[model samples]
Target: MEFTCISCGNPLSESDLELSINLGSAASMEEDVDLSGDESPPFALDAIDDSETMNFYSTMCTNEPMAESSTEAMPLCERCFESLAGSIIHDIQRTTRETGRYNEAIDQLSTVTPPPPPDLTALELEESQAMAEFQSVQAELHKLRRTLAEVRAEAEKTTADTEERWRAMNEAQREADAACEAARLHAAVSTNLTAMLASLREDATLALFPIVDCGTHATICGITLSSNDWAETGAALGVVAFLISVLQKKLDIFGQFTVSPQGPQSTIAIERQGKSTQVYPLHMARPTKKGAVQLGMACCCLLHTIAEVYVAQFPDDDAVSFERDGHSVDLDDRSESAESRRPIDAINGLSVVPEPRGAPSERWDLSWREALLCLGRVCRSTATLDPG
Candidate 1:
């Protein structure tokens, strides 16, 4: 099936040429007097016309290019359109041929402006009105050309602005991702209470995954630790590593007790006899002078120290605070951080706010898919936390 040329109402087909020749030599014989010329210019002027004489008049009206012959209408084969649409070879050939023919016609007409001029008062008036109409149409055409150029310029500018906006957006997203990654790295080494606060804003997982949070783990925020996810829970991708302290929890919290050659002894207790403090005593034979008590006590003490460093939660001190050793600790206080005081300006300069539930958070919406693609590049993960 083929489509018709919308502009010319003509079927587009592969034809070398479709020349139109207006056989008007008869009309030229006497200006519509009669198609009667005996000499006939030594060539056919009635039954046939000179090719040059015919083609000149025909070009005026018939050469109206088919508007649908536009470059857009690729209905014409590629090589054909390239050949016909102002091909350099065709242009040179056409220019030489048409120029020679036109010059010949002009020379012939120059030698023959015969007879006295006829009074053409009414004809002159009609010609004057037609000239005025032509000038108005020409002015409108010029205006249309100017308007088209303006529209094209505006379109180009809009395209450029859109590209620049996209570039800027990508840069901002990269900075944000780098900052979030920094915060993620820092939070992993922080305490449990800080972990809870940071986990409350855990949307970073979504951007890194297609559907599931990390493709391997299920919802891990508040689930059992010793279940199937003993693997994932121990891994850093899920949550703060709280379960690793299970062994530490089993060890008593009181400072370890010691057994001397003279029964069990707590040097710390004797030192703080007046003050209120508790202690734990691990049963063992009198030191055996082998420092076994010292060794066990040291191991227990080291485990507790590690737990305090990584697993201990911040005190929710719901009481008033006082000074000891001239130190200002949160004995009991109900105030926020100084940054929180000016919450609006906190800049959150870098934060790891996780994806919101019901709807995609303001952090997720983007202008296009590539925006997030660029962000996914910065999402950092480590193998040491694999728990494998």
Candidate 2:
């Protein structure tokens, strides 16, 4: 078993001095009665057991109880035992001196005079008045707190409502700006296209007449057709139908255009077969339709530009830039020739024409599928152009 000094935690062996302390018995020191005046010892040394040495040492040492047994023994080196015994003797002398001082203090207290007691009735009346004032102040403080809370709530609510209104206004302004931009683009493209195709209006109508003759057997522009041919032709027809649909939507927007309490409203509603109708704000619809128109116009412009270049190179042809009915029909004499001249003259004066832009030293050749794709690409490029 390992043993160490309780005070310093130093190693201890069997040969070390054994210092016994009984903390439980030491704690009962105050209960021991004095027998000095009767000529008898307060404790009879002969009646004590061998373990009673620890209790006697404990009573002569600290006032606090220790956790060990009343007869517990501690082993310490000779030097540690001498130091502890000296400390215990010094404490006992100090306690004896303190006891003498305490007795003198008690004799002085017995001779001193005491103050008179307070008047009960007057103190009771003052305490009651003070308590009443305190309660009244508490009630007023509580009322003020409630008022402050209500004011803060009102201020917070007002701030929230103002922020909500501000957000709504900003949203409406953004929508308005978008609508205006789309309308501007739509107006510009539609006007230019209407002017450019003014002469082609009659020709385009005549081109459709051939479709009626095509009937069950598919033939367009006097060429033999197959299912694929018909599908491609249908795609072309879809392009025309798309234009008419856009026009109808534009008319609807104009018709429904009005001012309300909320603000101005104009939108396009598209109905799909066997599906729910999709509605769009005018700003979104206009830009979308404008893109489609721009692509179609790009194809038209390319064709017109090509014809203009051919006419400039071969001015002696009896037929105008375009042929009709296997006979030469002069577009120069057409009523809209003045408007057509602008685009033609502009193309003729270009430093580089569209044809030379593709592969150098080779003419631009395109298959039917390639042509359709190229037309789409050209339209996208043109749509990005700033009308201004």
Candidate 3:
């Protein structure tokens, strides 16, 4: 007869049928004995489906037979048979583990005693005391906060008062500084006015000298001039040269000609094209024609420089000018005429010609007096004094 699985209705292989027949034989051998009489069932039927293989195993282990006509209905495919066997083995292992755990729990219960319950009264008292301390601490914290607020308010008031005092002090300091500055300015103005008055007095005194005396009877530094007295004339000329040098320095005049005064031995330097030519001994023991001519030329050059300075200061005024024979005394004038003859002939009566012999001292004194008169006019104009 053909055999098939009762669970899935699939034909069973020969090896499956052979394994089932061996299990049946083993079940028959144990039919007379009770395999599960003294202990619980090893496999749990609830753990697997109630399939035909399960039912077959259950009946065989209990020594129960199926109906005669349905004896072969217990056949199963290999897959269903393996699944059912695995479920039965898993249920057996789980039962063994549960039994072991129950045995361990029983052994521990017999060896150990249970602990007593806690005391509720002492615990309740401790909780109440802890709550009371917390309340006290909270009250102290509130009191400290109030004290801190009061201290902060006092500090703000003190700071405001300090600021007011500082502002007042600063304002006073500013007023004092302003007063000092005003006093300093007033003192400075007073000093400047005093200095100006003194300078005016000195200039007034200097204007009274006889150096600028342009009359027919001229005197030099209180000494009268004579035609024959060479010594007196020479000394007068030295004084004139010294005065001219002083005037040049006072006016801050600088140019091609520079004069250095040493009574009777004064010198004059003429610079042209960066070359300097010096003439010395403006006053000699016995004046020669050549010496007189050179002295005259030097005086003309000095006068020319002074004239230029005066013109610069008073560009519009033409009252006082240095001229000789109707021509201005210009040292650079190189034309052939009376203009060229200067500065040698710029001063009148200085040269002693052979045809009409004249006293050289007298001529020198006249020329120098005229030059000094022109210088006095310049000084007065610069000082804002009366030229007369």
What lDDT does each candidate get?
Answer: 0.35, 0.43, 0.51
Q: Write the per-residue lDDT of candidate 3 for residues 1-388, one digit (tens) a residue.
A: 8876766777878987876665454434443444555563443343334457555665543234543223333465678767867777886678769989999999999999778887899889998999999999999999999999999999999999999999989998998898899889878987996686456434422222232222122344555322134566456555445444444443443343455554455544443433455343345344665445534444444444344444454444444434454444443344668544433333232332112246664344433444433334433344343232
Comparing 2 and 3 by TM-score, which wins? 3
Cα RMSD of all models vs. native, in order, equals 39.8, 26.4, 23.0
Task: Please give the clash total of every predicted structure, in order.
Answer: 5, 1, 0
**Residues 277-303 of candidate 1: C-alpha lDDT, one tens digit per residue:** 333332223333223322232222222
lDDT of 2 by residue, 166-237 (tens): 999998999899999899999999899777555354333222322211211222333322222334434443
Give me the runs in candidate 1 sitting further than 4 Å from their true place.
Answer: 1-119, 189-388
Clashing pairs in 1: 201-354, 202-354, 203-353, 203-354, 203-355
TM-score of every model?
Answer: 0.20, 0.29, 0.33
Arranged by TM-score with the best first, the candidates are 3, 2, 1
Best model per TM-score:
3
Candidate 3's displacement at residue 190, Å, is: 8.2
TM-score attained by model 2: 0.29
